[model samples]
Target chain A: MARVQLENVTKRYDDVTAVEDVSMEIEDGEFVTFVGPSGCGKSTTMETVAGLTKPTEGRVYIGDDDVTTLAPKDRGVAMVFQNIALFPHMDVYDNISFGLRLRTFSDDEIRKRVEQAAEIVQLEGMLDRMPDEMSGGQRQRVAIARAIVRNPDVFLMDEPLANLDAKLRVHMRTELQRLHRELETTIIYVTHDQAEAMTMSDRIAILDGGELQQIAPPLTCYNEPTNRFVAGFIGSPSMNFLEGELIEGGLRTENFDVELDPGAVPGVGVGDDVTLGVRPEDVHLAEHADSLADHTAHIEARTDVLEPMGDEVFVYLLLAEEVQGSMEEDPASSPNQLLMSVTPDTEIHEDQAVDVVLDRSKVHLFETATGDALVHGLTDRSDQESGPTATEAE
Target chain B: MSDRHRTDGGETRTDVLTESHEAELDRGPFQRWVDDSIKNPQKVYRAMFYVAAIFFLVTTLFPFYWLLMVALTPEGQLQDIIFTPNGFNPGAFVEVFQTIPFHWYVFNSFVIATASTIVVLIIGSLAGYAFGRLEFPGKVPLLLLVLVISFFPPAAFFIPLNDLFNTSFFFLEPITGDGTLYNTPGAMVLPLSAIFMPLAIFILTTFYSQIPEGLEDAARVEGTTRLGALFRVIIPLSAPGVATAGVLTFIAVYNEFFFSFLMTDGQPESWAPLLEGIIAYQGQYEVLYHLMAAASIIGVIPVAILVIVAQEKIVSGLTAGALKE
Candidate 1:
């Protein structure tokens, strides 16, 4: 296994930039996932690493070699495609042993490695089965087995589980983690699914619009996003963003006022525009305000819709009538809508007026003009004095 | 129903409605058939499908059956409307050999068709892969130009090609030592391969493109070069298309008559094809219909076997990309 590094790698397709000046060094034997939305350059970056697509401008190094111009076979990287691209004409044994056969390995050696890989993937006794005869999950196992049989320096997976059903996707996610541990091979995975990134990767390289936004461990990214895009993109039922302007003592949104010292936040002055960001789970009802170490004053809201998700309920609350009026055009991103998460047993209903408070430590402030995180926590902790509690700013 | 009608004072009204409903049910046979289709359509569909299939099968195979009947008829007893052979005297098959060097004609056709088909397949598959998978400028226009080659009839190139074959250009030599390709297998094989290459290219291109691109990428990563991927993964996955192209090219080249007649001396020793030799059955005065039918049947046996063996491949190839997995 070897560390894979991209130094200022930029790939362009005629007029459209697929990836731009993106650089990251993945430690040897670490699983690094490049996560982003569709057309967000995550897959392009991984392709550059795998030598499938040559970057327009920069060097890609694997171990000590600058493999930017190397052929894929020469780069010592094996890829598992999103479609689980097994040779449909070949049975499992042949598929798994394709690389070995290509290199003209001895028949006995090929068979032994094929069997070993099949066993690792739990595909024993399926050596004679054609790809068409196998289920999606089984085919995926065969694809992984195909990659593992080669024992390449790095395994490049481009959304290998995207085509599987949801249940199987989850199962394969755990299986991939187990495989990574057993093999201790460097794996560079690309996916748009946040859950997969959070669960599988040692670190996630979050990208958007052909640019790298952040690359850090899963929890670190979740707890401390570097920018508004990372803060918004890293979570499911994504973080709630309320557009507002900084006032004398705090921030003033369309509907409510949050009292805080303006001097506490960096890169923002009084009367400057800023956005308040908080996750759905961090928004609690006024009754649970005492549980929080610090919290914003209760803001009046009317429950718009309540989704009961077995363990917790997602309640979409309308912050105020005027806020709704101002965001009528883009209702999906309406600043008036505040998503609050509570336990399933909590009594809640649609159109019910309630008071909710934001967890002070969980709240994040972003520059409204540039979509960059300004401050993570607004609470004054004089003793700790670490500047911003949640803004690690990696 | 009676109690409710009586309570509502609508017994006469219910009688009128039932009479109209009965009237609606008394549809014509055609209308009734259509009505029954909506309730359970599979029965009618099966019957119609079987009828159409039987009709098609009979019409398609009638000529071969008639040829067999003619070939089996006793000499001079080939009468019109004689469905069965007048008598099962299989001597016409043996006499076909005595009439002319028919075996040599068959051999000549077989060698020429087989060689030309192999040439076409090798070139066509390579061109097909390039056209189907590779990205390059002028790809669309180049493919269209290849297709345009098939639009010209063989007769359009006959005179110029025959002239070229008869003479050596500045750098190029004649195919034969006689300074001409006449009466040689190269005459037919070369022209036939060129003539049929376009169709093969089109067929193989369509099939090759139907293979998922990811398979090639996977092969590339697995240490196979682009051409290696073509042979190891792409061609095998596209077996149906390659088979279909090969079969079609072989059959067309085997059955070709115009160029075969023009380029050869119409004698088996000079590599004349089966079609010309079959026509030679007509002597100075009398036409040997029985011998001709016998030769025809023998000539068709190879093609028939090829089609029979690859019928499934041809069908699947034609419908390869019609539905996605």
Candidate 2:
């Protein structure tokens, strides 16, 4: 196993920059996933490490050797392409044993390694089947077996599971993790699906617009995102934001007010524009205000739409009566609307008036001008005055 | 009403078959056939297909049949226009051999055609792969130039080429010590290969490009060099196209007469191709149409055999680009 490192690797195509000066070090045997939206340079960065594409500016090292100019085979890295590019003319045995045969391995050794790999992929008794005769899932397993048969220092997979059906994709996610656990080889996986990155990687590197935004454990990225982009990208049904200006004791927007202790948030003064961020689950109803240790005062809202998921219901709350028409025009894109989640059985209906409160400890603050995080949680001395742990707001 | 009283399942099965058979009998024979044909349009289509196929087969094969009939007719009745030969003269088939050195002509044709086909396949596949796969400066323009060269008439280059072969190569002496390459197999092989190259290149290119580039990438990552990938993956996968090119070049060169007749002294000893040998029957006094037809039929045998053997490859190679994975 070898640790793959990219030092300021950048790739430019004439005028467009595919991957800009990005650098990261992955530990040996670590499963690191590069996650981003499409065309965000995540795959480009992985290609650089695999020696498939040479970086314009920086060096790539695998196990202390600068392999920036090395060929893919010489770099000791095997890649499983997104299309599962198995040779259609070859049978399973020949496809899996291609690299070994190219290296002139003995017949006995090639057979032994091929069988071991096929067993790992649960592909026993399929050595004679052509690729065209297999299902997509089985074909991808053959591709994976082909990669693992080489026993390279690092395995590069570029959206290897993207071509499978949704149900098979989930199953293969578990299979890949199990494979990683067994082989203990350094895997650098590239994917545009955030959930895949979250569930499989030891460290998930989140990128946006050809730049690295954050690289940390999945939960760390979900809980304490470094910027507004990461905070908005990590969680599904993304976090909500309210653009407000700083007041003396709290923040104020046209629809509502939030009280906060200035000392808890750094680099902020009066009249500084900021965006208050909170997840859908963190917005609580006023009736359950007693459950929270600290919360903002009750804000009047009217339920606009109710989406009933199996386990929970998402309630789109209109914060101001006057802005209802504009938000209803395109509810999903509106910033004036607050989305709150409650139990599926909750007594809620569309167009019903409701009162909601924000859990202060779960709120996040970011610089509205720069889209950078200011603080993750808010604190107000007035709410702490009720009790040390819990408060029932009036 | 009592017919509704069914017994066991076996009785019902026999009743259903009897009912269908009775219905068939009720309908007139032609009507039943018509109904069945209407229900399955494929039956009508198959019938029409056979009729048209037989018509075309007769129209196309009539000339060859006439040639065989003429070959069997004796020279005494050669003036008569008869569909059937009145005299069964099998001796004319033997007479074609005794008259001229036809075996030497067949040998020359085989040598030149085979050599030209090998040269075309080797160069055509390499050029096709480069044009089909690689990214290089001037690739588009160069491919267009190759296509544009094929538009020029082969006759246009005959004068310049003949002069160069006979006299000198631009400012240097000819490769041959006597300053002429006439009557040699290389003379025909070189020109035939050059003339037949474009079609082979185009055929191989279409087929080669249709192959997914991912296969080559996979091969490359598995430790094969670029050329190795070409030999191991691309060429093997394009066997149909390569065979098609080889067969086409061989047949065209085998029947070639213009340069073969012009470059040689019309002698089998001078390496004249089969078409020239057939022309050699037209002597100064009288033309032997009987022996000429026999020689023509003999010359077509090899090509006809080749076509029958590789017919599937030829069809598939031509239409390879029309398919998708």
Candidate 3:
């Protein structure tokens, strides 16, 4: 196992910068996933790390060796492509043993290692089957087997589960986690699915527009995201953003008001426009006559749609006044929609108005113009006191 | 009770039968005839199919039939106009060997053609793989050069190549040292190889390019060098394409006339090309029709067998990657 580090690695394709100044360190035996939408350079970063594509600038290191100039085969890293990429002409056993044979191992040694890999992947019975004879999941297992037989320092997989059906993908996800634990090798996997990243990665690295957004442990990233993008991207039914102004005592909306802690905003005095973000699960619903004093913000919106998932219900809501404006404008471009996840026992009906409470502790505030998160002022002051002095920092 | 039941039962039964008969008549004789035709249309189709098959067979095989008939006829009976053969004899086959050094020419032609075919397959596949996969300086320009050479007429290069082969120029000696290639098979073989090399390279290159890039990447990750992957993975996968190139090259070399005719004129005694004697021996005094026909038939057998054996490979190689699974 090896620690892989990218030192300000950049890749440029003519005028387009496919990966721009990506720098991250993967610890030895750590499972780090690079997650992003399509064309976000996550795959490009993985390819750069695998030494398949040479960076236009900067360097890559595996352990203490600089591998930027080395050929891919000499880099001592194994990559499983999204398509599995098994040699169609070779059987499963031969495919697994290919790298060992290339290294000029003895026939007996090659056979032993290949069988060990096959047993690990549970593919012993399929040793003589061609890739076409195998199902999608089996083909993926062969790909994993191929990588495992090499016993490389690092394993790089690019969206390896994207081609499988949903049920098979879940099964393989757990199997991969088990494999990672058993092998304890450094694995750098790339996927666009956030759920997969959240479930499988020890630490998740999010990327967008060729820039690294955040890299942290899964729960840390979920609870305390670095910015609006992270906060919105990490959660399912994504966090809802409501436009409001920071008034004298609380955030103000058209029909409702939110009370913020006095020390929440330090730099700004009043009348600062900020976008408030609250996750779907964090929003609590109450009956119209109930007292919502402890809750910071309260809004009454008519339920537009109800999706009954097994554990929770997703209630899509819209303000009555906002609905009138949306109807006047284009019916499709409305922005007043909100999705709230409530307990399965809660009763909600379409077109019925209900009071929703936003929890202040879980809410995130961002600047309207820059989209930068506004951390609570009390925590920032405490952190500043404990932080390094200028000369010591330098 | 029996009298009452008999009163209207017979009349009702007759009325129902009459109604069914009237409905069948209304459907018309044409409809009935169409139904019968649909049930047994294969008979008419089979008859027409047989007739077409017979026409195609006669058209295709008549030339070969005439060639065999001429080959078996006596030289003295060449002028006979009757369709029926007076007698059969193998005198022409023996006479063909007696008049010329036929065995020597056969040996020369076989050596030249087989050697050229092997050379083309090896060099062509290597060049094709390089052109298809490798990234080096002037690659695109070199590819364009190959395409240009493939389209250029072989006759255009004859004079320059002849001069190069016949005489010492610049720093190098003539190709065969003291003896020029003017009356040797090398003159024909070398030039013909150069002419067909581009075709071999083009076909194999196109086939190699259709293989997925992921397979090569997998090979690279498996610790195989680029060249090793090419030999062990890419070449084996492209067997059909290589076979196609070999077959086409063999056919072209086997049938080449102008180069063999021009180069081996002075030494007709050494010319073993299958069709060479047919033209060379067609003089005013002795036409030698029987011997020419027999030689032509013998020459066609190897090529026909090769084409039949390699037909499947050719089709698959040409159609690879054109359709999705």
Interface RMSD of each: 3.1, 3.3, 3.4
Model 3 C-alpha RMSD vs. true structure (Å) is: 6.9
Give the residue spans of candidate 1 off by over 4 A.
A321-333, A344-354, A380-394, B1-62, B65-89, B169-180, B285-287, B312-324
Cα lDDT tens digits, model 3, B7-123, are 889876777789798776766788876777789898668878999999999999888888888888877686663464446877767777787666556666677788888889888
Query: Higher TM-score: candidate 1 or 3?
Result: 1
lDDT of each: 0.87, 0.85, 0.79
B88, model 3: CA deviation in Å? 1.8
> How accurate locally is residue B281 in candidate 2, as Cα lDDT from 0 to 100?
85
Each prediction's TM-score versus the true structure: 0.86, 0.86, 0.83
* Best of the two (2, 3) by DockQ: 3
Cα lDDT, model 2, residue A354: 89
Arranged by lDDT with the best first, the candidates are 1, 2, 3
Residue-level lDDT tens digits of model 2 in B85-158? 85888787789899988878988899999999999999998999999888788988998988898888988989
Error of 3 at B260 (Å): 2.5
Question: Which ten contiguous residues of candidate 2 chain A have the minimum total lDDT?
Answer: A385-394
Best by DockQ: 1
Clashes of 1: 0
